[model samples]
Target: MKVLHFLSFFGLIASLSLEAAPKKENRKPNLIKPSETSQTSIENSFPKPKDQYQIRLIMENDAFGGFSDQYYTNGSRLEFNMKAGESNPTRRVLGYWNDLFITPTQSTKYLQGFSLGQEFYTPTNIEKADVSYGDRPYASRAYFGNSLTTATEDTSITTELELGMIGPSVGGKSAQMNFHNFIGSPTPQGWDTQIPNSYSGALRTDVRKFYHRFFGTQYNLNLGNIQADASFGLIFRFGNVDKTPGPGSSALQPGPPILHEDGTGYWYFYVNPGGTFQFYNATIQGLMGSDKSYKTQNRNTAFSNWDNYLNNPTQEAGEREIQYRALAEDNGKNSLQRYILFNEFLVNGTSNPYNIGLNYLLFNNIFNGAEDIEKSTRLFLLNNLAEQWDQIPDNARALAIYSIFRPEGGKLPPQIRLYSYEVLSQFILDPKQREVLLQLLRNEIEFRDEKTYVADLKRAVGFIKVGFVSVSNAGFLFGVHYNYQTIDFQSGKGLPQQHQWLGFQLGKVF
Candidate 1:
């Protein structure tokens, strides 16, 4: 019944998004032309001046949508855009980077943009003082971005680089708390468990092609620790639209300046429907190879027993039994302890071949070192491994295992290999024996054929934006948009699957 309700809601939104705008002939024609008026003139009596520079301030807040404060809560950006030329520092820097991928043509006009932005996310139950393991983590990202765009009449290509910091230093906690106090909302309690501070950088490239005045397609590729995904989508526009170099709106990001040839006003409604192939999202899954400790357990003592067991092999069976019992006592107290126990059980006493396959699968796929493999595939494989593990042939497993650990080349991180060595070193005692055991474990990872695992993280996202751009004869510009987006990720229990926000922009042409 709940699924049906969501489906119905999405259907209604789609209908509204695709509604055609009223025809121009249906509207009353303006009889007077004013030199300066609050509203824009449909027709310009004189030639419009070319804009050389633009500065814009953009703000987005979910509170405007009247939704709960969870997930993507708030964001803001300040942007400056200018014509790209040899004298521009941003153009000179990004131009060199762009040349590596695409050579600019003579007809291509270049525009450079620089921006500073901050965005933050929260879990469903913000009032909870403890971490919510099943929900998305609390995260904040503040970045400075520089981008270069090359455009013609029908198409545009943009390459952007963003460098920033993620975590408490970004002031997400203070910002949210202060705002909540101002609005008389419940204070978020889980910010103490937010993702730790870390340096982050990402490269993003977008290509947009307009097939007709009102229709176009856009493709985007993003790579970095913060997000890794590829997306393709179609764009539809109606009402009074202009011939912009790229997508008319930057959505949430900073965009190139709009070129208004006649300094007149224009307004449009647009719908963007798209699907993304997600690879990794550090904001949800945590950073790769990060050693930061969380509030879940006592970091110093969480693995003391396991470490002791690995460091001492000559201990009596009775003594080993006592250590194992101690671990059992600590289990269920916290997430970290439970995880350790699970790994230990798989390593010491799991007789089922299927369970053995699962152990290797969890370690290899979850802690993947390869950059090309999709991180979401690990979740899919784990969910289905039980039903399919027995079907894999032994010889195939051998070949796969051999290929993964060829001695001369392996992609596993040094930290993971070292951790594995520490665990085995105690039992093997001898260096040579331990090396052989490590190789055997690596071979076990190939039990299921690599080709058998399929990625299942593709999700469709829907966007509806209704906005207007007005440029005064004096070169002033202002716009406001109401934006709505369907679920972008798989929401956890008791979480909203849709989000909406409002954006306001104020700019000037100099």
Candidate 2:
């Protein structure tokens, strides 16, 4: 029965796509007449300006709906797009590779896009410290994506590839906990049980065709370690829609803005109804399988030993020192500790102070032909520098140190840049100073750059999305959307079978 329903859904999409599309003569004219002499007319009289490039930011969160904050809690992406032409390196490379596999199709236009995004998922009850058995696991993915789109009069096709990492290494825990702290929400305590670290990638292709002026059909296939699925959908547009030969805006789908021949601007409301057939979901089922137990055991042991050390009553000075050193080493290797450190490194590595200290550390340790230093020794020196600084009361000596470590403006070798922040952090003592370092590190991270289950899983899931888009003649764009999805999995915990969220988008074209 489930197989029949899924096949029927695909059949419906196929029939919809085959419907007689509106002819050019039947379409309403969007261009102004030259005789009207209106400002828009005057603008149209000039050669149509080409929109060669665009940048977009997309964000989605369940909290925006004023409802729950679990299961696909939050997501964000930044994307850059360009008209595909000989001048574009990404287009040339990807196009060449594409040609080797499938013959190129003739299309009126092409676009190439690149993006970086992060999203995290949690169980229904985020406040619980224990794993919510039979519910979704705490998981996060940070990925880089590349896409190529080709469009004709009333159709567009997009092929995209995404590569990323999943687990604690991606900083899901830090992102959620810190945000919750800022917002006064209960901290999510079960991230220690998040899926083990692993690399993930996906390839997806979508084909969409419009019928008349308001209706369209789409089909897509996705395959990867992260997920495997096929989906079909219908799209409807109303109001002052752009009749351009290109892709339409989607709040859930991160990509380039629709290319317009003239900067006339537009406003429209759209609805998309879709269904997906799932095969796999790594975020819920996990990729590490049996190895998950081993990793969890190690993490638990590390935390347990650290707790013991902190509460121990033995007070021998020498023994305490030895224990402290050993604990620091162990904590350094702890998954949570590493997650925090990774986030800190990414968030603080770009500050002037951080870079200055990093440069100095690199110069001494790697570039100056000094004796090679062990990573542990370097870590110890960096960690203890602030304590050492407190003993030196001479302000002149501090100034001298700052002057010696200040950045001189040449790029450091790329290999050591990510690790250099540890040393750089040693120089920062004030809370505000540390904040400055962290802000820079985050800037660099940004500015620089599913599995299916079996009987517990629904074979088909349906979703609906409604949104409005507004664009300025100056090329600025903004949109807000509401999305709802039918349950794709059965948790049997009285958790809601329906989930809804809000999405926001902002973009600019040049």
Candidate 3:
């Protein structure tokens, strides 16, 4: 079948690509530009370094036509630059610097380097039941990858190749079946109600591939003041849709199995190995940086680039002038201001920002490399925090606060302390709330001390949900995504499902 051949081709490509990566890295030439090799003033050579960390909150939808027929998505991607390479200065054809400096001075010509991070999102299905027969229910996946960036005078473009996996999608679809308490009798629908035990079974099945692979490349370009990005990739699926059978590869496993409660019939379920290739694009414009210190010192500007003012601007022309100047100097808008503010104002503290000084705890430390238990606990904490940001129970909040402020034997890490302060000091518009938070941080709880702090921080990593909303205009953007997917057995037969969407978007970045 065509599907089988396509899967084979992709599998081969994946294997070859992984095998060939290191060889290609070794083959890269170490030669650098002759002009840039010459020792120039450090100040002149290095442009202002971009922030080491970037957090992007993006909401994408294919609802340009109407809300009734569309695909919706919401997510955030956070990136951290582990190593930022140097920029390659432009060289003339036969210039003096090129002639005088012939030896290579750098390992690569790229201005920027790579980043590592996570992307998390949820996609939902909302098609009409009568007209549409597709089912694309909401699901979440966390993807991690490294993105390589190329920086120029007025532009910086980053390309990222990332992969993610998901397990069984219907493990909770039949939770009401209770096999233990059986009092069956014939009901209206010819099903047992009481005498014969009106119960089927509480069966939970999980069938998933070891590598429900989703690999794709995203190109994000910041051109002058305009920002534009696009990505294309595939989602390859091949695995068991049921329980794992001991120690074996997922490639050798079949799909899920269906069961009948009355032992009347049994059927096997399988999704032929297949893939879906998708692409997305968007553009935004606005203020780019929100760090006041960075701007006043680096660009000699006295204005802040937060979106709060732009969205709720005053009628005064003078204030508007100040905003315009700030925008011009900042180059672009900071898309994550609200996200930063949420952390600084609502998420981080000895207690919830609104409930400070309530005898909470804090643990500020990191797990060592070998602390597997601590690592797992941290992951669990992060997942819970992300999932229940607005509805976190008081007890969970207390536990998180206690764990984050937990102390070690000596001083806490400088970065940890600084980060705590940074998140604490911004976006506090209410005096009472500010006072309570400050009091909580400055004072200590009776039972929480150095010993408790050390133990907790060593065991669990601190985490919180940071949210933001912004408006920007970077460039013109439009896109379409179509998926010809196969659904589970429909009326005892397999059927093809179709999903399509067209979107046109425009925004700013600052």
Candidate number of the best TM-score: 2
Per-candidate TM-scores read 0.55, 0.56, 0.21
lDDT of 1 by residue, 185-214 (tens): 766765756777889999887777777867
Per-candidate clash tally:
0, 13, 56
Give Cα distance to truth, residue 281, candidate 1, Å.
Answer: 1.7
Error of 3 at 465 (Å): 31
Model 3 root mean square deviation, Cα atoms: 32.0
Could you give the candidate ranking by lDDT, starting with the highest? 2, 1, 3
On lDDT, who's better, 1 or 2?
A: 2
Q: Which candidate is the best by lDDT?
A: 2
Residue-level lDDT of model 3, residues 84-169, one tens digit each, is: 34332222211222223223334211212121212111112111110011112222233443344332221223333344321112
Instruction: Rank candidates, TM-score, best first.
Output: 2, 1, 3
lDDT of each: 0.57, 0.59, 0.25
